[model samples]
Target: MGILVQEDKGLFHLQSAGMSYILQLVNDYPAHVYWGKKLRSGSNLEGLLNLGGNRGLDRLPQEYPQYGTGDFRTPAYQVRLEDGTRITELKYSGYRVVEGKPSLPGLPSVYVESAQEAQTLELTLKDDYAKLSVILRYTVFEHTNVITRSVEFTNAGETQLRLQRALSASVDFSSGDMDMIYLAGAWSREGNLTRRRLVQGGTTIGSRRGMSSHQLNPFAALVKPETDENHGEAYGFSLVYSGGFEAEAEVDSFGMTRFTMGLNSFDFAWLLEPGEQFQTPEVVMVYSSEGIGEMSRTYHRLYRTRLCRGLYRDKERPILVNNWEATYFNFDADKLESIAAEGAKLGIELFVLDDGWFGKRDADNSSLGDWVEDLRKLPGGLSDVAQRVNNLGLQFGLWFEPEMISPDSELYRKHPDWCLHVPGRRRSEARWQLVLDYTREDVRQYIYESLSRIFSTVPISYVKWDMNRCLTEIGSAELPSERQGETAHRYVLGLYELLERITSEFPHILFESCCSGGGRFDPGMLHYMPQTWTSDDTDAVERLKIQYGTSLVYPVSSIGAHVSAVPNHQVGRITPLSFRGDVAMSGNFGYELDLTKFTDEEKELVKEQVANYKQIRSLVQQGNLYRLQSPFEGNETAWMFVSDDQREALVYYFRVMAVPHPPRRSLKLNGLNPELDYILEASGEVYGGDRLMQAGLALPDIQQDFVSGCYKLKVQE
Candidate 1:
């Protein structure tokens, strides 16, 4: 039995007829160094290899040998030459059915196929890279939460095979509503399609984009990993692709990327030679309760009993507050204490004192490694404040830009040779900081030991791991020039190892990855931390637009959105608190403002939001996420998500520009059980199902009165 399924440790598990293969999916902030684990990161795939029952590998698995494809994983198809060489490939037929038929042959068509409980596809990797012959597999409904006892294992050499190949799949959707994750480099969108400019630091590398059927909204695009990594060794070390919002189509205006034809991604490709076999990447389907629906969660609690870990405590997470936005680089312990005290009053579950708490960090310009408490900044010592915050009925968290160092710091001071710089050429520096050479065994050990030591002393429940700068002048001081080019790849491996060590040690601690704002936020990084900070700009108005872009791919629970101040700290925009809260409520809701300065009215508003979060959190976080209006494209945006039972629904509507007494604004509400009679609670309005949607609602002269409204609807059985 050859099978690949999503597992608990942020990856899909791969198995063969009689051999083993390890599959790990990681979200890397390519700009920042990769985080912990005994992982090896290839171009398109990364993470520790599960060579034995429970032991992890030092690098990502290159090829799965159990299968005949020779590559890590291919599709259901395979090929063999007259000379007995197997060729795992599929030539795209070029077109697909528009309403419900197959392609007309050269029209360039794509889509994924999935039933109620499973999704599967195939591919041919004969172009771009070298030696072919492969097979890929994906179980549609089984996604990211099964391991052996649920985890996938690695198979060294299981057959007399000869060939190399690649395979992968992405649930192709956009990340418009996601927070802290930014494509800040270069980006553009056309129709329901958008492309992110893939830049290393400040330079452009390549861009990846997707286009789907005009009328059919699938959750994602599943294609074969057919990219040529330029070297032409028949190697495709990496690729990250996606599918769609299978649970909630209405979250993004009901326009979904449902599924695609193939599982085309990075890890799917691999190399197999003499005495080797092959394995395919796993596939898993995800179902939730809050925004999309709950049928999947309640039904599949034991998704991967063999390979998956973590107790099934599907309860509400703690309400945490982060200080990254409140005080970027200028806050002492007293200042921190003030912030933490206010958080306690609001009943926030955790208090995270972000950057500047370590080293000689007075300005945004220096000292990364001085992990010890800054006595100069906090005369009371950090432990004292942690105790106080604990006394205030809140858990504590701290921030660290551990992967970086500054020219004005002690770590860099002691080892100028430790920075990743070219021998005689000047290196690029951001925020007056340089990245630490984690490739060195000594540097990796120091950072890991320091963090472990600090965590042992503090009762910190979370760690806001922020990487503010991207890599520049990439090269290592220790590695030979031959593998110097491997520096970028090696840096990522180092990062994964560090994070692996941290998380394994502090299994209870919550970790966050932030690169300035959302730059490093991706599925590659999500493996370590469950969620990411969506972005740094907190203006509600701007956020509505920004979040629209983020929500395309990510789920609401994964976005780090917060309610900040007016004349927003980033761009000066004073939006109403109500608007801010309504938008922020769309994601992992939190606040990044100085709570002490909030007026009593604002405080009351905060209390209300907290309550609202409690009431509808299950619906928002777990339900199928939908997008009703294009916050970016439409004049007025509206979208709603309904639970499977159809008893309750949450609809968010925003009027971007009010029309001057327009004749009539037609609103077509989707996701409704059209036959059932329903009532809109806010207006005390009752109308037949079709008319309420087709005839639409007459929005008042909203420019002066209502900007946005969340309507709750109840359906009569």
Candidate 2:
């Protein structure tokens, strides 16, 4: 069993593939002891508990801290009674170890393939004073060193209770000098990996933008001072939520560090009536003693296999060409057909007609909620364009911004209360769009049914589900005054509901999530939609950093990387077409350029890029990834993909600048079978795996900026 209970020590030790999570009962409260490398003995806790006893309150690590506990640290969970009392002291009740994991209600969670592959521990604690019970769920996988945790709170008293704070998972460490690493960016640039020392007070990063905005992702990491990509200890935490969330790391006066992840505490309150319960979203935790690279690999493997679902989870994504950047709003049925024709000629498998095909929408300012086809753009409707593209030997895809409503549209005019707004308050708009109040059941049904109808009628093999704006007004007319604060969390729940319905109803449609671009890209969205448009910025130079940072926790298969025309649409920096292709090949390879406008030489280059991508698609999509060099640290970036069987590998290296005289850069490969002989496909050079990993391969010195190369290696039997 992966989960074992130490009766004598009163500890629940969860042993995953290469990690151990220890939870001990301190006096009565469940306390987290250690969560790093696997423990061979219980000697580590020799004096941890007694050390805190002299401080009056046992400062022993708490799984869920609360106020009035003598400890002044921030509580992991908070609740308020009917009389306005907001204190809770929960004691360990009992626990049950099960063979398999249980699915979280109305949320995206990792699944267990079989009972033999995983084990779950359901630990229950009771606050007898408040008549409340907290159930902490933990699941450990047998093959992957990942443990997922979530919380469920039940009100057993006769009075109605209000949950002021409910965090999914919390980890406490008695040590100091921890570094907190997170991702932060804006629309055109998402997932900029950042590292900072863990300071005192609260260090919080999250999104209150309804959708997990591009501002801050819900994933975080806490590492020791010596931690890096390939060394030391690091603990990674990612909330399996796509909506508003907060990841907080706080260092208390006692020099103890605690990390918590859950619903954003800002304006987030869930009302729980007696006999009712509230379940927080799940959080995936990975502990890597072998460094950040091991942490990334654990997350990559777990999410790729357990989190992301459907036909696209393990299959090669189609080499797609979206029409968003190519023609924008100027394209009509003829233009789309022409683009699809060119894409088919270039061996592209998917043709996505983005944005302008919808009702009265020539630009971004109108027709957002109107699902009907724009007769001006496509005389025969979206179905016609889909069929036209399908006839060109390409899978047809359509763009949809179903979450936004333009006030000037028919849906808004018919139901003025459909969009989120505050009574007598001015409604805020972004990109000239208002968010549909999905917290309303009617609104959710309308959007889901409308899109479902389109998917059923059109031959659409793919759907680019986009949300172009953040939430504002922050008020829901549907809820009462007291429940107004519940709007944000409720909105997220409604979104998950709508997504579940649509994806379940239209199982054949490949849904790719987009928020402007990459705004809502998180584990929660990946649960329903396997891939996300990495970013709206298609510049090769910019994407190198964006894709590299995103791949820290997200797998390459989940990132939507496309070769766009240069000067790129966002940054307007024109690089060589080959550079764009190489950058895009690192992810779900695709193109966003208008192929019809390409010159003869560019067209031939596009064809070659497409053909070459096919040769490495399987390896890139399913293989183990290794970050050889970081773009954030130097002028060059390098990464490699090794097959699961260690039989083949593909390495990508990019040089962003050219120096007058540069030093030689050697690339070292990882995760290869050391005893095997390997052959490089491009240069036909043969070397032993051990030699390649130890001595490293010398990369050719290209004297041009933005130049890249791909090296494919296969084991020589």
Top candidate by lDDT: 2
Backbone clashes in each candidate structure, one number apiece? 168, 0
The lowest-lDDT stretch of 10 consecutive residues in candidate 1 is 228-237
Q: What is the lDDT of residue 389 in candidate 2?
A: 89
Across 140-220, the per-residue lDDT of candidate 2 in tens digits comes to 988777899999999999888899999899888887689999989998988899999888878889888887788898899
User: Which ten contiguous residues of candidate 2 have the minimum total lDDT?
Assistant: 45-54
- Candidate 1, 1-717: lDDT as tens digits: 223333344333332222223344322100001211112223332333323442121121322222343322212233233256554322221111122112111111112232322223222222112233333333322332211110111222333332222222322222112211112322112113232222211111222111111111222211112311111111001112111111111112222121112222211222334334343223333322122222122212322121122221244456777776677777776777787788777767778887777777877887777788888877767787788788878888888888888888888779887877889989788789888887787988999888998899888887888776656677788987545644654565577678767877788787766656565544435545656676677777667765665554445555677888777877776678887888888777888878888899888888888877777777776565456566556576666656656666778877755667666555556555666677778776765556555665555455542277777777754
- Local error of candidate 2 at 644, Å? 0.8
Q: Mind sharing the TM-score for model 1?
A: 0.64
| Model 2 stretches with alpha carbons more than 4 Å out | 41-54
List per-prediction Cα lDDT, in the order shown: 0.50, 0.88
Candidate 2 TM-score over all chains jointly: 0.98
